[model samples]
Target: MRLRSIVLIAALPLAMLAQGRRNAPPETPSTKTPAELRAEYIREHYTKAEYQIPMRDGVKLFTAVYTPKDHSQKYPILLMRTPYTVGPYGSDNYAGRLGPASEKFMREGFIFANQDVRGKGRSEGTYMDIRPVNPNKRGPKDIDEPSDTYDTIDWLVKNIPDNNERVGMYGISYPGFYAAMGAVDAHPALKATSPQAPVINWFIGDDFHHNGVLFLAHAFNFFSGFGRNHPPDGPNRDRIEMKTPDAYDFHLRTGALANYDEKYFHGQTEFWKELTQNDTYNEFWKSRDLRQYVKNLKPAMMSVGGWFDAEDVFGPLNLYKSAEAQNPGAKNMLVEGPWSHGGWARPDGTALGNINFASNTSKFFQDDIEFPFFLFHLKGKGDGDKLPEAYVFETGRNEWHKFDAWPPKDAKWKTLYFHAGGKLNTAQPAEKAEAFDEYVSDPAKPVPFTPYIANGMSYPYMTDDQRFAASRPDVLVYETEPLESDVRVAGPLKASLFVSTTGTDSDWVVKLIDVFPGDTADPQPNPTNVHMGGYQMLVRGEPFRGKFRKGFDKPEPFVPGKMDQVAFDMPDVFHTFRTGHRIMVQVQSSWYPLGDRNPQKFMKIQDAKAEDFVKATERVYRTNSAPSSIQLSTID
Candidate 1:
């Protein structure tokens, strides 16, 4: 629910921490339990303190600082700024854990600080979602995330006891945005920063919208709880009560986008209103694009994300590229693991759903990469020059790969073309005539994004089997023969579609899949008794709003039955299709409640009437002149 929520690294309780340590020795009737031992250890080793740290704008942010009890040596300050509460509230209450990930940071002993950014929790000043960075700060009043971070750091180094004049910042999701912002024209003491799965551009590619298409279920469910205003330091807003547990049915029955405000939100949620009004990629969205502001960063940086991250997949990849390009010669690195949203922070990262990576990838990242990164920059404890530019996990092969540059400099661009008889190959379509595959997209019977029913966006849907979707008449399927050798694909995928619609507009969904061989065996203890043979594992999928094909800011209606090009870049993937696996592609007009209904007519979809939602016959052209294909960056 709420799209797995923005994971708070230090929010893990003693009980949950104990539960995650599966191999820990069990407690006898007289001996202390793992939870008790951990709680005792934290209390003994750390001293907690609360502060109302003032920002440049005169607003005070609530920060909880946990310093090492052993004050023999000064420690670097590791800070995380979040809109979410930095709680356990009172000075007497101690967090079960500290740092960006794992108890390793706690054991390593640093001054851990977590702040509730402006407006949320006990913080003062109004909270603005993804606050636009102020490029020209004329006065102290001109404050943004960067200024607040600077103020916080200045205060910590000058006032906090037993502090080294060094600071590091890291956070996931919303806080990751703060972390990235802190790196821009960074404070002198802020030596290192990591923004993992940060929310970059909301309208383009992030939580709520993808290519101008509103992620209906995610936005709706998320805002239902997080979109409201409340008294400072109060509890989180209650989630909207759903009439039914099935999200697909509930969303569909809720009717047009207008119905959401009319029935549920009742114009109460300001952000939801903003989302509806800013349907196009206008200044409202552009100003909040973190990519443009990452220029000339000063801190040693690392951008982290999950290959199957359901949310914010676009953030880490593009942020890393932007920082690398803008900061030229800066110590910028990218780490992508075979994990879901915030998966690297979790105790286990061996698998997501049925796909297993065959290693404790999270532990590897925490111990080898993240810890070393901070140590080198913040504490001068490791070889900073040794870190790779790109540390990515290659799926299918389930192995880690380091590269001098992402997309690997040696990888070549190749196209996988769609052909007749559901065949997909590297060869260009030979057909001279207008050959195409057609499907009727009816709003009444939309294609479900996943096989199972849920009340919210299911995180596992990122890599779930696509057999259910492929079997639908409304979806087009194309596949290649089993590979003779491993076909490894790295970097972003580009979907270039030559298409036509009976209606003026439509939504095009593209999915890249790996088909397991018929002889493949099921997992050793498959509790669900799932068949592995012919499993169509979805590696990546993205939807494009047809109207925005020209540009995100420019929306144009399609000429019915006239061929038009709809091309967009999906997030990158590092995956290997082994010799026994077949590469598959599925294209559809509707991904259903995963994205709001298009109405198949060119108008403000948020204001569409029921009659505007009509059935449209969609065609994907694959002629010699109009070859529709997916461009991939592959390693030969």
Candidate 2:
């Protein structure tokens, strides 16, 4: 692929500004004063200091605060609590305060605090798992990070002299989870916060279970990294060394994920042990979930997440909804951009895999939007404004839109039925018992998330390799009738299906896809003639596994012969399937290497031996009693 010039024209209408949150100020006229430039430079050149503060539990957590030296008055604080160590500063002396990565907020003279969570960095306290404010087990009410955060905020207010009595929080990935925790029962001093790419739902949404099936790569990688640093102890980064295998050959290596217990569990990883041991939905995971604890959310929040964020997308979206439902009075905003997991924090926002957004969308949001959000909330002297409750970057349209509530109020619940022979149609099949789609799901050979295999760290969500999946005989692809109008889906989605299998337990994956008609493969379209950055198509997709359909806890197995109606919730999407495009739904038994393979036997997931890797024939039943359908939030 040849490189285009760095200058890609900004496509959005300049006049369309200032519509959301009382129309933003006209793109701050390029400042051109010697004094003004000097002020901006100084604001971006603040010094950073490292310190360790003790929590109420007597745990000392490390923190790095970047304060403006020209501090004539008290300034509000912007804090980021993270497990990943916060790097101090750049090597170049004159290069200044924080790097360009933080140029937005730094240029606004706001105090930025980045601290390592307990059990990480120079912080003290035994690092347990992502312990929420409420523990699942019936034990002593042990203090968690939320308590630690309250203690830290209390200490900062009285001790840090040149500080206003206000603070805001935000972070990406794991740090995002901490930010969410910080808001559970936020400190009195905390006024505003944003949990970007936050871990809102653990088992069902975040790192592990997706729709019920365990996210194999994410799970294996995370455990390999964090599991190496087991509980009742501090974070041990040195113990977890990633094992490198050939990219394409990786699937073959991971025969039965349950076998991992025999290889690695030296009696230290009880969670990992429990994870593999309990493949069925049980009480073990329900307790660790954060969805139930998302009540009484304080701090006016701006929940940010990536539409393509492979790791924590479900968490942030679900978090925003839960917050809205639980605390309707609290101000909450959601900003979703076209980027990979925490990719916005990086410099370039190019194609994650085969799809490209045609611009550095991440940089645009960080510099133009996210920074201003903090400045407006934390500092009184911002652009004198506020952003809307939901500011989403629509992918297919290549534009931005805002609304008071998610799913936009006018969206309707539309169903796209699965037709015969891998066909997706709007009309339900007239014949009641013509046939069913059957596929044998072998635990030994499961479908990979991508065509090419790689480490878990590689961009998983950024890909267009449906060709490999389409080739698999086991996969079922159901598409919908071409839409007569533009259908906009913007909220939580659910897939209800009637299924049966020959084995006691089996996994079924339901995927919602946006199929775009392309020009015949032979002729290459002119580059200059490219309409909307050559993206003349829309292809959005999400999948959910079967067993955990009802919920993470209390998973009942297939009775070997009876039909089971399963409802799996698909992740939310803000898509506009245009007039010519079609909505699609693909049902299959496996999304593997990415997701751990289920044994079809209800035993422990991680401890299944080689003999437990049985090949089971799965059946999809579509009758009057067993109606399988895909439901979407469409434009009313």
Candidate 3:
């Protein structure tokens, strides 16, 4: 796991164990020249700047090279390619230097390089959102990410100094994705890579859609902030903003989902179009899969993620597995922490808004692990102290556990069957003819994610709080008996249920949670029960828009009231359901503004005319004929 800059920004003490390379000594007045001032401010930290680097197609990507200024000796080049501009010090500012972020990397006697990918930042080319794939029309598959990385590395190895000829790539979020892409056709000098919170796939496992349902808050927030029309080279823009740019709040106050979409999407939301058009696992998505590429990389790799990471827990886990299966020559490992999306690195690893994580996990990752890993790989020292295959934090017990592989060898795959009347046990269904639970999902009034926020951004992408829905009359809640011993669940979670809906089509949201018993001892001042004790909080949840259940790109109307088997794989999880904690699953029709309201009609979701939006009733059946159950990757 790596330290998140978000946490680093807030929690880092000015004098706390300074994990970075020692700051250069303060110079006397006469020694501080204008160049020194620029260096001190930025350039000195990053000592080299090389702007034009030609890729295979002759497209020159803008690159900023930062080298350790103090050491005249050669060093390994650490590369980071990003769509985000290789800022402040480009061609115009000829004196090559490191930005504050690259200073730490440069100090360790390694060449730090940040480049803009083909279409974004300073690079030349039209920016495509995550570079989506198209049918075989384009030229040379349009010089994909992998090729760009391959060309960049080839340029770095031959041109840079510190002649060891070894290189490593690392980045977080979008850049993290570039790191993964770099490993596909890795250069001989490319020895290692760490993809922190990378975007592996857009639909199946990203901030946008999961199990066919749209992740409304994250998707809309992302698009509105970093939409396609963003200028390729310009001043950094506000990627994260609290308020919506448009006057859609007026429509929201009107309390209508239809009106909001019409005004915001200009009646044409590409997001809506993408979601509805790709209802099944069609070629549109198949061409976009990076697993084939991820599986083939040879670089020694690490996948870092956070349990509470609202952004990308799914991508890391899937990348780890895919790489493990495909890249036999590489050493693969995963590090997960108790923090939120990209939480491992952030300071104040706490509950959203008011919650707190007892301790600062981010500091530990940066100082003790992340920094060291890069230092050792780039320098070829400290390799003897490399960690085990997996280092994970078990939340229930609140301790770190190391294993040779994920899911720990001793873990036994266990199954807890869903029984009648909100009962979950290992026993088979007792009733041969069990009835189904039904709920009405109104497109007008969908379920709110939490009790607090009205229409603000919700954390539904990560934690699955089902308490509000459990009490809802329309939802079906099934829970397992309190654990006799601490039960640890690791790896992907799948739910196979026999479901039916009354309308032409609808959606189902299934959530898996570790329910903490109510803590009656409330703490005052910090009242509002802020993290004081156990409350039925969510662990993980995923939604499946029913029409796309059969496939993501193809939409097929549901057979109303007919029992159809449905399944969705939850993001991988590592949790210890403590002795007294209960595991619960809730099935419902809508999760609202979290997922765009699914019109009960079967038509293409994007082309879903404003009038096509309708509410409908859905049912989940559990009987001998259709024994609905959730299959978890059991770790005994």
Best by lDDT: 1
Q: For model 1, which pairs clash?
A: none
The alpha-carbon lDDT assigned to residue 168 of candidate 1 equals: 95
lDDT of candidate 1 over 238-293, digit per residue (tens) = 55878788999999899999999998888878899999889999999999998988
lDDT of 2 at 283: 62
What TM-score does structure 2 among the candidates reach?
0.84
Q: Any idea how many clashes model 1 has?
A: 0
Q: Candidate 3: which stretches are off by over 4 Å?
A: 1-45, 90-106, 132-142, 228-231, 235-262, 265-279, 350-357, 454-461, 520-534
Ranking by TM-score: 1, 3, 2
lDDT of 2 by residue, 417-491 (tens): 666776766666666663577788877777666655476635644434364576687877676566687877777
Error of 1 at 576 (Å): 0.4
lDDT of 3: 0.68
The CA lDDT at 598 in model 1 is 95
Tell me each candidate's RMSD, in Å, in order: 6.0, 7.9, 6.3
**Models sorted by lDDT, best on top:** 1, 3, 2
